[model samples]
Target: MLTRLLACTIAFAAPLAALAQTPPQVSPAVEASAPLEARIGELAQILAGKGDYDAYFAPAFRSQIPKEKFAQINAQIAATAGPMIRIESITPRTPWVADVTIGFRDAIGTVRISVAATEPHQVDGLLFSGLTPRVADMGSVRAAIAALPGRTGFALARLADGAPQMLLADHGDTPLAIGSAFKLVILAELVRAVNAGERRWGDMVTLDGGPLPGGQYMNVPAGTKVTLRELAQKMISISDNSATDILLKHLGRDRVEAMLAVVGIADPKGMTPFPGTLEIFKLKGVPGLADRYLALDPAGRRQFLDGEVARTPIAAISPTLFRDGKPVRIEQLEWFATPTDLIRVMDWLRRNSAAGPGAEVRAILGLNPGIPQPAAAKWKWAGYKGGSEPGVMHMTLLLEGKDGSWYALSSSWNNPAAPVEDVRFAGLVGRAAELAAPQP
Candidate 1:
């Protein structure tokens, strides 16, 4: 047994003897060992070739790289990896450990990167892009608004992490009437007309006595030659009824409706002729009669009810004026909108303001471009247009504050049958603006 064991040992020793006896093969090229950093760089290239971009060296190599230079190195890795080396994360695992996780888009799939050192200077993490933090919370804006007595919807958006982000909303996609805010469509069309050479800003419309009081047309002086631009200004800024009617007449209701359709406002029927404009005037002509029968004072509302007229026409008109939130003469006046729909109009107007010359929609009625905002501590700049037809009161505003943030507010009360004296109707919109506008 001993001899057999000896024989086995001899067999194993014979190969060692041959290895010692044989001369070692030598190559013509001889390279010295490189520093750790140089070795890490070499390893990075190898891993990059192997579809492991996160395979960067940890420890001593990581200590050599500055934080600012890391981005450049990461970019270089991506370039070398041909789109497969998606960087996930690069972070320290421990004082002595560095980890890199690499992601490959191709067949090789994913790999984790880990490098450790006895001392400092190590990078350890998964290397890839898309690692920014995001918080998806929109409840705050809603909670703030829900405190109010009425229902209103809103939308908010801002830049976050290099992209447009929607931060708040409630039924924000639904469309509504948007009232005089539709005038912005007229402004846009006028700009288009100027661009097409069909009309110029200086083009004039002669105001005639036939269009005014009886208050059927706006109360402009007879023979007033207002420019198209001036008409647009008054129409939007002060919500002037006469200026709007002239522009509406000159531009044609059908053309304006078509342009509104292009901007995606639903049901562009407000511009069309309706009996309400004339009916309201007829009703306004009646005086003490309307007040006596309606049980109201008649001193202030010269446009609504004349104080001197007899009672017979007042009795005849009161039912028609106060019916079911819907006036008998003009059904379209019953048209009102949602808050979200108003945002769309404001966004459209902002886009219009950003357009180039001949495309500018200049303000005519409200605050001019450079006008200072109101001085009220709570109220800043309130550039707005208001529409009131009985139970319906609509307001659109571009509100800015001391904080330099701007909010576009669109609000309408649909209770045309509800009393305007309810005050809450207007207060609803005011409350919305108060909540939305930034504090002084």
Candidate 2:
């Protein structure tokens, strides 16, 4: 066993002696001072001395990035990581090399990165062996949008592209009353009736009374015969409540309610064509009213007045004394609705592709364009309806940004106890609408 071990050792010694006999030459000064170029030399060694270059370079990409992404980053680093990069740090104090660091900007954003690499001898520079860029964040844009007061209440949803979009919301899924905005529904029903051979677009309807005060119904003269199409246009574009009521009567409240129900709206107040109980009160001869208020049942009437229906309360005194000698008062009725309901009605119009400009709610709201364009440039469509009774002043609007994004806005002022100018509330509505409108 000893003889065998000796023979094996002698064989190893022979190979060692041959290698020593032809020792390679190296500069003494280069060997002595190479530590100064530590960071640069380490990188040079990696590029030139490593047998498996990938094995040495692979760790630089120790990230969850996809292979393609890694390759892209690698290419970008190779092209931009010049001597501006330097050895930022290193673990064990390497005798011959410093650490590596890099800084660069690309299509994405700027990046300042550090890694342990060797120092460059050619130009007193550091060679980067590892490189990476900083990731960009979009939180600022989201914060800016959220911070905007007018934007705070909007509910966000993702678009097809995974981009955030918004919708005006009021808690649950209640249908908006839209006041005369409901005229679009009337218009839609009229068109449907015409299409179904039930009526003609040019069919004439006679008005038995003059327009109500502050109502669009006054636009046409009493006893004047007008085509259905004419009434619809006036009712919708001008938000004529009288025209709306008249049209609603013609279309039948039941039909409208049924249509709304089909669209997933559960609010009976919103789905109802008119407050049936409230309509019944007007029929009871209380004064300051019309026959339209008689459409509701007692329970429905009570339900309508519940706090959930509207933020504003019914007026103590009625706005009018009679509707064609039919007595009525707002206080006698129990139903209430808010401007938010009005906007929801507009949404329904758009979703159902009902009548209005382009038969879509977006076209009616005129907000999709963010700014009011010229009539020739799409008219900045908008859905607007205003309501007033004694101290009650209310308006609801749905505006669309130029990109078809929408905003629902409602404003109401109930100061029956202290009486405010109706015009003031109207001005507020306009202002809120303007504020809610999207801008480029």
Best by lDDT: 1
Candidate 2 ranges beyond 4 A from true positions:
1-185, 191-200, 206-224, 239-242, 262-265, 270-335, 338-340, 354-379, 415-421
lDDT of 1 by residue, 28-126 (tens): 442222232333344444444442333344544344333433544344334323344444433333322222333443211122223343333233432
> How far in Å is the alpha carbon of 219 misplaced in model 1?
6.0
What TM-score does model 2 achieve against the real structure? 0.42
Question: Once all C-alphas are superposed, what RMSD does model 1 give against the true structure?
Answer: 31.7
lDDT of each: 0.41, 0.37
TM-score of each: 0.46, 0.42
Candidate 1 Cα errors over 4 Å, as ranges: 1-179, 195-197, 212-222, 267-333, 358-362, 368-382, 400-406, 421-428, 434-440
Q: Per-residue error at 322 for model 2, in Å?
A: 9.9
